[model samples]
Target chain A: MHYTEQSHTFRKIIMTKRITLADVAADAGVSAKTVSDVIHHRGRMREETRERVRNSMRALGYTTNLAARTLRTGSAKLIGLAIPNFAQPFNGNYADIVTSYAWAKGYRVSITTYHRLSQGLRELSADAYRFGVDGWIFLTDTPIPAQDNFLNQDRPVVLTGDYLSHGVADTIMFPNVEASQTATTRLFELGCERIGFIGAPANADSLDVTTQQLDAALTAQEGNSAMRLRGHLTALLQHNRSPLPSLVGACTRLDRSDGEKATLRLLDAGAQFDALFCANDAVALGAMSALTSRGLRIPEDVQIIGFDNTPDAAFSSPRLTTIDPFTEQYAQMAVDCLISRLEGDETAPTVHITDFALIERDSTRH
Target chain B: MHYTEQSHTFRKIIMTKRITLADVAADAGVSAKTVSDVIHHRGRMREETRERVRNSMRALGYTTNLAARTLRTGSAKLIGLAIPNFAQPFNGNYADIVTSYAWAKGYRVSITTYHRLSQGLRELSADAYRFGVDGWIFLTDTPIPAQDNFLNQDRPVVLTGDYLSHGVADTIMFPNVEASQTATTRLFELGCERIGFIGAPANADSLDVTTQQLDAALTAQEGNSAMRLRGHLTALLQHNRSPLPSLVGACTRLDRSDGEKATLRLLDAGAQFDALFCANDAVALGAMSALTSRGLRIPEDVQIIGFDNTPDAAFSSPRLTTIDPFTEQYAQMAVDCLISRLEGDETAPTVHITDFALIERDSTRH
Candidate 1:
């Protein structure tokens, strides 16, 4: 839809079957992607090869139809939702909710995944237009820096996650600090003395503290793990408790296996605790498996609290009690914010945090 | 890359920062999408809108730069991986494995999800081009009909799943029948007198069998559930055990919650079985949760086996016994097939199925 060429011979092709880019590529003795590269002048090739491809294009009349018809129909009212690969339960679960809300708001959602974390933010959604979206909603695990102009690279953008966007774009965040604090506080109220924590930016080998020590940690740090750990620490300090490094476990990722292995290592090291505050529900579920496998009972021998409150939390054995950060409402607000931006609301970009609640279940004492 | 326009006065644009589509949109008093539609000639709009957007484009000199620069560079060889959604363990888990293999083979992978089950095959692929995919590897749950041509719409396509493609495209299939049959037969060898099953197409409300009578069921059906069920039935018939309707639980989805509720329903209905053959790992995990919640010992009381030996299976309490469908190998084969097609293999599309094995864990007695 963004381009047009003048005065092409429209009648050079056969009508029996529609000619394709691959058909032209075969005739030119090149790949279809090569033919595409030539069509878009994407990468420079030898002039002779370009002529041969152009000749095949003319002979098949492919350019007049298939190649020229490559423009996406702009009528699709599309929104691009970008997620870092869907291995973790929260990423896919949140994406499903966002797609539903986006569709209900009369827009079709297309997904694009960012893989290989080492590629960094330059690779994070700097190419939304190529994937064909009028705007983008990037639910990222990476932290956005102050000058993160990738936020609004020509399209109205909404950034979600526990990262601080510095208002470079509209942001949606979970109450990583507040809710973790509250979850820890609740475990105390449930009659827990020593509490263990899982998930930090450290490896499973004895799990390093993000700061030199937990007491000196930045409560407003830039990661989900670090911030949540800070909140947990705050609650411990408030209760006049000395920090137990043995009770804190670290994970490389927030996946279930990560949780299970980390929990096993803690148990192997004899890191005893009456309660556990996990990073997310996936980790919590796996930790429960670890505890149960050892004949430990939930809410009696060791109480547990998880975050995110994913569908799995509700169905887990003992019905996992979790911190619900109002995911549905957060999804709705994000869509509305993006729609407002698309509708010419030039107001300064803002940060949005949804309300949180402790969803009590059988995993915790009443 | 398929479009170009010439001789526009680009000097009118501001030199300080790159002009964005939203900027032009704001100046033209239209949504960025509306400006996009006007630029693309996507659909019919009021003539007045067309004129106003053109005026804004001319005024801002946006046409000479940003709008004309929408072409994607063909340098990046890319593939599209389509799955139902990432919420399912198999979907996301399989996708991550495919992405790694695709990247190693020098292809960037993009994802697009198909939501709303009622949308069907017309929505299945038919529009891979609009999503800017060079080719697609569709891991679909929907069955493809005999005359399905969405396989190759100008671009090379590869379809993977239990569903038959009627040789419409290059296919990578799991040995659903053989592996499942083996899984059930092993339970009998392990001295299980009665076996329970979860995951049929029917709902949790007294799960319905596909055929009116189990004996008349089509051994060669089109779905993962039906085919796997047929394999189980073949094993039962081999052992001369009458199929117990109450022991057969049905699930609309193969998610964790669905498995939990279905297992509870079967147990509540007094369906006594010595073993349980679950459809997938997510289902198996949940079923285990249900049994454990009910105070039942794992292998001693009820031997359980699951499909898709996901990472979760290794860490699950009792360490779940599962059918190893060679997911990583399946991913490699699929990538190799697509690459061959891209490099112009020109051979007849072949059906490929990966080998399988029962990985004995604590959930099953060795």
Candidate 2:
């Protein structure tokens, strides 16, 4: 044999190509459709032939394209969700709950965080348009009125809580004001003489009108706010309690460090308050940590109440007595509403409100 | 006037619009271009005219579409990034670091999380394709294998540590095996005779390779791995050694309750162990909590070490000794690589490995 002929015969003998689906069908004396059906484990194949096909598929290396299958079904099975920030424990919990819920619904959630509330809302609206999210749930904190405009335009958007005003997007609102009022009232019912408030002043200024309303209803004081100082004094005087001095204001910052510093400032100022009501759990926890270091016994010397029943409340060394704002319920309801909107339910923006309950724990047992 | 005549007069009045830009220029005694410049806040406009134009805009409620302004400049000012399992603490930190970095660069990052690893990769790749992300940084638990044919097709992709195989996309990896070897060696230096190992089994298997290498380097009669019989033999041979056996097991199921139960089982089985080397901070914390509950003092009685120096590690009751895997560094590097690729850098895959350092805290110090 010539050299070229010898080389060609050697190449043919050495390179044994792997069997394809076509080869399997030809060898099995069946149509390519039958081979494909057997490969996919679709239907109606005899056991012996199924076994033969399965072995053949293994012998060959064939991978199915899931994307093609998904395209055929017209479902990408994905949902896009965004939140303001995840660094905060509460928002982290929110992201976690929404993700778990979305997963249970056979849809995957894509989560992104935005920092500035104004920017977050605009990005959310635009992202929903650019990214083909089945729907969107915005766990927002933007108090800007423009947030409403962007949300209204975003249509199929869900608002996690009363964090934003309604009539812009479908809203899931927690009874924040009601919860705060209830938390304040619980202290009074426990025979507390004087109560001081510690929270970020900036947050207090942006206080939702409903929260303002709840404060008004609870104390029977009507104005921009239910003056905690005035309420404490009125309660003291009306109940024939010992005459009290004006309430001392703690720093308005709501973070853990702020709470700690505020408590220290209150202590330093010689504020004769019997109970302390914190703006949120972080403030309460920080205050407790400070008080503990000062050798003060909680509920004996001072009763403390916190807002937002965070998961940390249960795990704290001395579990905190706080308000349960039902954020998860609000989130779930928001998802439901947004899904409806995405399904073409163009109902006028409606607000869903969930109630709050006071959870009495070791910290406030008088 | 009759109602129809009154309506016609009102419509005529409404149609009589305000002065146009030309009228503003003529009134202000400037060119139309100068008036337009003043209105748009162009740099060349005089400060006085700019103030006049600002006042006019406010009076007229002239709402500028910021999005349109960006389009005029051909910039969206947004980048879409995806990560797997943002709920995981490490991924959460990763997201925060990258978000801040992106913000510093004057770009907003739209984040999404995919729970299932491979599926997340596919969805993220698709998201990049459809959403027109300025760029993408794909953080995964595993490197994108070329054989993951769907992912190999195209798009700007960067892989982070966990899977460090060669011939893949631009990759960054943590030197986990190297770090584990160093951590293990440190334990030996600290006079820990019976070191128990616990972590995800696959991670433990990789550590086993490191331990084997260490044995060869040390040239000691002791084997890197301690089988039950081998542990018993070592204890029997060393006169002062406790009659306890070391264990290498899975950390996947190790939570607080599981730690308590597992410790009880090990204690009941009379397995003597002095030190535990955990896979992650969470497992280490659980193990430490169990040991202390059993009246065992850490380090003095049973030293503990963990991987992944998460924030909670330092704040842990008995601050866990953990390996700082440079997670932020890894995330930043991954972002840079993705940006470079987006900027049209076609360099071969560059592997960046971050060295791990042990943070000695309360748990590891007697």
**Candidate of highest TM-score:** 1
Candidate 1 error regions (>4 Å): A1-76, A147-149, A203-206, A210-212, B1-16, B19-76, B147-149, B203-206, B210-212
RMSD to the true structure for each prediction, in A, is 12.4, 12.5
What tens-digit string does per-residue lDDT give for candidate 1 at B1-366? 111122222222222355668887887788989988877667778888777776666444352233233332332366877777767877777877888888888876776677653343345354544455567788878776554345545567788877776776789988888888999999999999999888766744546553354554435666787777778888888899877677787888788887888899888878889899988888898899889888888999999999989866876677899999999989888889988888789899998989999999999998
- DockQ, structure candidate 2: 0.11
For residues B1-366, could you state the per-residue lDDT of candidate 2 as single tens digits? 112212221221111243366655554556778766764447586666666654443222222222223333433455666665544445566777777776766666766666543345554554442333555676655434444433342455666635543454677766665566566666766888787665433243532223343233232221112221132223333434333223544433334444444455555556677887766665666677667667788889988887778755654445678888888787778777777776689878777877668889877764
Model 1 error, position B188 (Å)? 1.1
Q: Measured with DockQ on alpha carbons, how good is candidate 1?
A: 0.16
lDDT of each: 0.75, 0.57
Give the number of the best model, judged by DockQ: 1
Judged by whole-model lDDT over C-alpha atoms, candidate 1 comes out at 0.75
lDDT tens readout by residue for model 2, A60-153:
3222222222223424455667766655446666766676776666666666676643345554554443343556687665453542354544
